[model samples]
Target: MEAAVKRRVEDYSLMDHATQSDPFEFYAALHEQCPVYRMPETGFYMVTRYDDLRQVLKDTDTFSNDVSAKDGKGLQGDLGVLYEEIIAERGWAHVQTLQRTDPPEHSRYRKLLDRVFTARRVREMLPYVDQVANDLIESWIDDGRCEFNSQFAMPMPGIIIAEQLGLGRKDVARFKRWADALIALSIRKWSEPEIRQIAETELEMQHYLFDVFEDRRKNPTGDLISALVHAHGDDEEPLSMHELQNLMHQLISGGFETTQSAIAHGLWLLLRHPETMQRLRGDMSLIKPFCEEAMRIESPVQGLARKTTRDVELNGTLIPAGSLVLTRYGAANRDPEKFECPHLFDIDRKNAGAQIAFGAGAHFCVGASLARQEMVSSFTALLTRLDDIRLEHDLPQPVHNPSLYFMPMKELPITFKKR
Candidate 1:
């Protein structure tokens, strides 16, 4: 690096805090000074600029996801990295089941669930999706005031996921809790005892899904889980018990929060920005762009973690091997150089397709189409049925994770004007 370039690098350790709510300021600073930043505390490389994030995420070879951080560094002491060797081996089963795999294995596992989420299948699922949304609207319409998060946002999408996987709605509360913990655990540190409790609960979740997969093998059903057991009509290797359970875990986990947050957040966006909300309520066609803008403004998943394999130059910064490389999907979506008035929530803006919310490349979110459909169905149903939907109170400040993986709301109360 040139002397001037070396001088531009700054320490971002001071920005790390337990009580921190908004870390975007750090991201903005990093974007301006250095697209590739090294946090002083954790030593992990942070990529904020749109091009840089795309570069790293698209090249998975140099940037691996096995997550053995380089030189024994990167997010050290995080409870997520505290597992023993034995636990680490067990966790490999968990990891191999989803995000950690590469190429052929990744392709094989991803294909099993792909058919259900493709555009054709998503359209087939739409009537059922609309029914689910309308059912929630019916339940909440009489109340006039509702805790929208629990009453509507949480239930409808989760039930769709449960049925898709051959699970029942009875597991909603437990499944929701487990999903939240798994996402939050990236940033939230827990006591030893609490970690043990969560581990045991995860085991229970695994076992429950395993039982469903096993039973389906004996009595074949058409559900995704059963099909996976029978290789889903694919000539690829039939999923082992571990692979079957893990694949189910990923599908269920992906559906649990991304759809919930998207529904809750699309509503939050419509409620917070009066002009956008008014425009959307008036024009039915803008629903597509509105969903696009909401995702850009408030992405369901914040960032992705990758473990680097070899030294590679990214926008003049050398990312050493085995380091955790974070592609800031949330931050990149707001890169002003790429999107005009990036911070403003305007659905009419051009280049709406430029947002990185669903991610880029082969690792892109598997359920992007399903998520978009759910948002469209839910928003259309809400606007058609509920006379008016607006915020009943101020949105509690949005939550941020040091892990930068989720944008979850604490609470959102809503009032609906009777049609």
Candidate 2:
């Protein structure tokens, strides 16, 4: 595969556009040619193959997840100085928490997160998820039309995460504003002013979470926040205030945005593939794999950054130490070597569960169980409650999130009969 390489490692601009429009094609070419290519412009090594990406993620010792304070993933290197200034002005420490932390800190946080966010806990919340889905559907069912993304796909996860954290449903809008800012910061193209605005908004989010944590400490509502406030690490020392705030932000942003994007992208993919949709609507049992397929085909998170701790070799290519690396999950999921007929939307694909939409290794998404349950409950309610559901806009706009990190339909208007 490496013998036919024609694209240079510095051709990131071309790759960026290709990724935005059709990531599978771009990655397919890379996988067959330069599976482990470095980007000279951004100081990142782009790993597109499935096995190569997995190797980087699993070998945490060799690939440090320690992100720079100003730009953790280093994708936004252009704004590093500005970010440093912002951190200085705001008294912020850009420490890696949860997803970005390497062990033993990653192990410590994972254990604590798992305690509160277990599969059992997620299962217990199924009824609540169903109720939320049904309620959202009820609001628009009688109207005979709805913008699914805005009405259901967007707010459902936000509401669930807010309630889980003991925050009010009324606060979801604020949560979204904060979430949008964080996602924007991850995008490489945002201007310095835009990044500054996000930094300010994040400061606002931090302050808000601080208030909530204090309230949870005093009142002890038994929600996730309260548990986190009192929870002690393996060292038996309680989580510091900074750690508490960082974890809270991660939960809020990760829990709400990614799942919401997944649901939206799932619908977009299904609507475009009616046979798959009809099959899922009929069998119902296929919904799980159907969602899994959607995740693989249009992963909400395109990729995540990892920094090399030491020199590493993958697929016969050697990456030097201290280089930024990007794990292209969107590309890896579509590798034909990993999945048969990677382009097709096959709900019955046996290995659909192997998709790393929620990531893998020790840093796999903690809210995965919760997200899956929410999606299953949502699709169940959506398919059964809306009859003859179809897209309202012909040739609807392309699916793209505001940020480069995510890919989701900006607006998905649809019409259906009230069942």
Candidate 3:
């Protein structure tokens, strides 16, 4: 009789696409035996089941978002030696932004920013969004083909979010660059030069934001920055420069990276599933749900790290206190227990909204409404302005950064007939 080979958790590569084509399949196998599997490479526990993820996200006391604990070492601890200098020199230990902080402090910063993404504010962005999407399509509608990532997908959210944040349209490229660097840091391995590049970019982004905030202070505009600069929560003082910087970074990256990836991925999904594309083309109103379904299938932001405040037991496994736990939003969104035929990209999915693409609980993405708006508006323009839109390449390849945190299509070449 042949001996069975034990499936050691370390044997799987979380970041390498070469090892696995479908991450959901890889995770599904892992979830079958060990849903809360601890990674040997980084020692971060990954929770793949939908119920467990919801439990961890909701139980703020046991699972802490503010792993930094008043010291920005959370990133350093989760990322190891790569972030040693970043933690010390950059004062990373002190950062407890809305997404990273828990409770009382989190609510304070969240409330101040919440006003900016209110439904009315998002509604106001519709016309500008229509203009941006149409302008991009107009530039390439005649060419019959375009690299959708850089030309259309990347810039739609980039321009809209920049304008909303009181930044110049010319700075959209810069915003995308900074956001890319931030996501790159989540990777386990990088060359010295890459690390230096990230550190330098962080400093530049900080200085650039400093000047912008100074201008906003002196001459306020009806933008998110102005609202952040002037507003004070109930019995709370206005945000300090450091707090504002961290918050601003979160807003820009969250709004830019997540939405851009969704737009690109959504287009690719529609191209791959021509039936869904034809259905959407006919109805037109399905664009909204199509965006949600795309997000559910290929979540832009995959997973995030949280530190345990105390010893916790999940699914027969006991995790020690202070250990880092990674909740797999990508895996959870596709768990069979949560969604029927989870692997299929069903645009008419009745419960597509249940997906945690925007996360859940207190740290849920504040820009969810804005992201949804961008995706719906951009796709609507494409469907209206383009005819017989299809992928230029028979097997359109999706290039993802070798990081588990994000999955964005690197390039999408598609040919379309102008209407």
> How well does each candidate superpose onto the true structure, as a TM-score?
0.89, 0.93, 0.92
In model 2, which residue pairs have backbone atoms overlapping below 3 Å?
none
Where does candidate 1 stray beyond 4 Å?
1-20, 68-92, 232-235, 398-403
Q: All models: lDDT?
A: 0.71, 0.79, 0.79
Q: Rank the candidates by lDDT, best first.
A: 2, 3, 1
Backbone Cα, N, C clashes tallied per candidate: 1, 0, 3
Of the two candidates 1 and 2, the one with more favorable TM-score, higher being better, is: 2
lDDT of 1 by residue, 1-419 (tens): 10121223464442345223444555566667877877675676778888888877777778765554223343435444543222334442454745767666577667766655668878889899999898878877988989887887888778888877777778788788767655544554567666666666666677677678779989877776776677656355677776765666667677887788888888887777767767767898988888988898777776768888888888898888767877778779877678776777788878877788988877788888888888898888888877667778876554433444666667779888867
Candidate 2, residue 248: Cα displacement in angstroms equals 1.6
lDDT of 3 by residue, 1-419 (tens): 11122464456667566432347656766666678898776678889999999999988889988754234343334343555456347643236779888887788877888877788988987898889999888888888999998899899988887887798889998999887766666645666666777767877777788888889989999888888888875687878888887887787778777888889888888887888888888998888888888999889878888989999999888999989898888889888888887888888789998999888888888988888888889988888888888878754333654566777665888898888
lDDT of 2 by residue, 1-419 (tens): 11223454334342364446455656666877688876656667778888878888888999878766454446566576576577557745556678778989799888888889988888888899999999999988998889988789988998999888898888888888887776665665667787788788888887777788788778998898988887775568777777886787688788767898899988888888878878877889988888888888888888887888888887887888888888889888988789888877788889989998888788888888888888999999999988788989774434564455666567888999877
Per-candidate alpha-carbon RMSD to the true structure? 4.3, 3.0, 3.8
Candidate 2, position 316, lDDT: 87
